[model samples]
Target: MDERIGLRERKKQRTREAISNAAISLFFDNGFDQVSITQIAAAAEVSRRTLFAYFPAKEDLVLHRIADHETESGRVLRERPGAPLATLRAHFLDGLERRDPITGLNDAPEVLALYRLIMDTPTLAASLLRYRENGKQALEEALRDKENLPQLTARLAAAQIMSVQWALSEDNYWRIAGGTSADDAYPAARAAAEQGFDQLAGGLGGFL
Candidate 1:
């Protein structure tokens, strides 16, 4: 029955969350490299086999936290009404207002710690880069399919938009990480995002 299936899915989600939380806590306490699958599995009270079932690789145990957001921009473009760039610009600004971690304008201690962990770990950093590249590809597809853009145009616009987003996020992250409170940095962060999008609009021109 559907009820049984729903319960089974909820149980799986809980198990996955427990394993992820345990892995992150151990990584934060003892460094990512120091933590092992067996140790995380034991902490979560799950077998190593169960852990692998949820997260196929060690890097995934950490990166899975953000996997859902990998195609978020594309999803936004596909679902929201308006010109593609305008929708994306509005979404980024709205994320800033909401202190979304993806915007890199959040100052929560755990958020900052997780960012540091990713930046400090080479393997995780590399994995994140791959995620960003995948995000770009997804956006390209959305542009072509939803917005009716030509293939080359979609590819070019997606690259530009992704680069701008990356630059803006990095700037916001460093500002907050360097001791500026998110509330205090909001004005500059908002301004930077506006400018980044404006520049994108200028570069893409009629296409957007």
Candidate 2:
């Protein structure tokens, strides 16, 4: 039964991946606004009903990738043994070195295009904001659980951490999109990241 469940989950994951790849390719080819759910379904070789079952809307087709990241910070906090803030700081630094898109450090053409697409598209931007909020809540809960802190303290810490993280990424993304090479962008990005994390560590005390 466990094996059967694993296979079913894998199949669902494959379908979601196929659909997301098709949708992103179409979105990048044409504009996000120009792509239709039916077109995405056709590109992915799935029925409209099936596509909708996986993704609720056109915006979700793109932003689900971002939305899916809502748990990542919490996971990092929970899985690592050291201080949560230190762990998170190291995670972002690693992401920067690896050119992870979440760090906005990748200057690849597709990555640049995605940044432009999200900035230019209102629906995607709105959806992304929702995901960011969800991320904050997830982090807050994790902090509360791991620290046995007050709810208000967790909320405040989460807000600060999420804000700094977002600011760091936005700064890097704009620099990269504006023709700064990733290597050239690294110094400023690293500076911003350090400053952001330092601020987070300093402002949110008692938890690490």
Per-residue accuracy of model 1 over 89-132 as CA lDDT, tens digit each: 99999999999998899999999999999989999999999899
Model 1 segments more than 4 A misplaced: none
Per-residue CA lDDT of model 2 for 36-79, tens digit only, reads 89899999999999999999878888887766577789878988
- What's each prediction's TM-score? 0.98, 0.91
Query: Model 2 Cα RMSD, Å?
Result: 1.8
Candidate 2 CA-lDDT value: 0.87
Instruction: State in Å the error of residue 110, model 1.
Output: 0.7
**Candidate 2 segments whose C-alpha is farther than 4 A from its true place:** 1-8
